[model samples]
Target: MTVPLFPLNSIVLPGGRIPLQLFEPRYLDMLTRCMKDGIGFVVVLLRDGAETGAVARFHPVGTYVRITDFQQLGNGLLGITVEGESKVAITRSWRQPDGLNMGEVEVLSEEAYAPVPETYAELTSVLVALCRHPVIQDLDMTVDYADARQVGWRLTELLPLDKQEKQRLVELRDPVERLSRLQELLEALESG
Candidate 1:
């Protein structure tokens, strides 16, 4: 299916929530159509260039997201909260006349439910503590501490990992492998 692509330097994995402001004309139009049609859009990680003006290069794998809440901020910008639904692969992309990026995409398969392994169980505990922070509580994320997929994704999003590292994790289809990678990264973080 074809969907609008909102490229950013950051990556949001499935089950993650992100707030964005719509001010660009093309983006504003895209938001209107998506909300009216009750469809979602793809948030791809920008590989090069900027988010506005010229067309930017973005990673093929992206998270399909739907607008969950919206408000007109006091500054007059339209603030919208979007929740990630699933991962999508962009097969082809092009810019419209108004500079909005559109893409032909296929939704990636969801990870099967896998319980967190004993070795990485500590990661889940860390995630639980991170979620208790007021800033994270505001996102209202539904995380299952026992599920490997949930534990991997929530930690990958909440951790101070670089954008490329997060994108790599988001593209991974295996929950266990993702968790293993996170554990290794966390270990290295502690050592450094």
Candidate 2:
């Protein structure tokens, strides 16, 4: 199905949340339509350029997300928290007459992961710590994860990775592999 696209410099994994500001006319309209239709939009990583005006480069892999809560910022911009639903692949994309990026997207199925294994106990424990960090405190992060995949996505959100690294993590369809990569990255982080 076709969905409105928001290409930003950040990647949000399934079950993660991202705070967004809607001030541009195109996006403000998009947000209204989404809220009215009870649907969500796609958020892809901006491969190049900015979020507004000019058409920017985008990663095909993205997360479908819905606005969970909203408030008016002091400057009067629409501030909203978006919760990721699932992964989507952009089959094709084009700009609307109003400059909104619209895409024909495919909803990707999530692969089931086994429960968190003992090997990643340290990694899982650290996720709790990561959730309480000041930077993560604002996202309204969930501190509990039932499975390794949940842990992977949450850790993916918490880690201080570049956009490219985050895109890689978001694109990985295999939950176990995602967790394994997270573990490796955590190990490297500790060693560095």
Candidate 3:
């Protein structure tokens, strides 16, 4: 299914909720369309250029997301939250006259569930701490924390990593391996 593309300098893994503020005319229209049709959009990290100007280049892999909740902020910007649904790879993209990007993408499968090592079970406390950030805290409340793969993805979203690193973590097929890598990164951060 072709959906509108919203490129940003961020990565959102499946089940992650990313909040966005919409004010631009093109995106407002996109939002109107999404809310009307029950369609979502592909959010890809920017590889080059800006979100509002120029022919911005973006990573082909992205998260397919649907708007879940929204409210009007005091600033008058439409504050909306989108929850990641699945991964998608852009086959090609083009821009409309107003500079909004629309892409032909193929939806990818959910990351396969691999049994996480028991040692990483203690990481749940760390995740709870990470979720204290208001922006992310709500997104995970509904998840089954005992599910190790969900734990891995939650950590992936909370990590202080670059967009590319987060993208790599999201693309990892094995949740067990992803957890292992996340543990290593956490250790490095603590030691430093």
User: Which predicted model would earn the best TM-score?
Assistant: 1
Q: Count backbone overlaps in model 1.
A: 0
Clashes of 3: 0
Model 3 whole-model lDDT (C-alpha atoms): 0.83
The whole-model C-alpha lDDT of candidate 2 against the native structure comes to: 0.87
- Arranged by lDDT, best first: 1, 2, 3
List residue ranges in candidate 2 displaced over 4 A: none
User: Which residue pairs come into collision in candidate 2?
Assistant: none
| TM-score of candidate 3 on Cα atoms, chains taken together | 0.91
Residue-level lDDT tens digits of model 2 in 167-187: 898888777788888888888
* Residue-level lDDT for 142 in candidate 3: 60
lDDT of 1 at 57: 94
Model 3, residue 1: C-alpha shift (Å):
1.6
- Report the lDDT tens digits of candidate 1 across residue range 1-192: 999999997767788888888899999999999989999999999889997788799999999999999999899999998999999999999999999999999998888999999999889888999999998898888988999998998898789988889889988999999999999999999899
What is the C-alpha lDDT profile of model 3 across 118-186, one tens digit per residue? 788767778867778876666545655666778888888777876777778877878878878888888
Ranking by TM-score: 1, 2, 3
- Model 1: which ten-residue window has the lowest total lDDT? 9-18
Taking all chains together, each candidate's TM-score versus the true structure is 0.96, 0.92, 0.91
The global C-alpha lDDT for each of the candidates, from Candidate 1 onward, is: 0.91, 0.87, 0.83
Q: Once superposed on the true structure, which residue ranges of model 1 sit more than 4 Å away at CA?
A: none
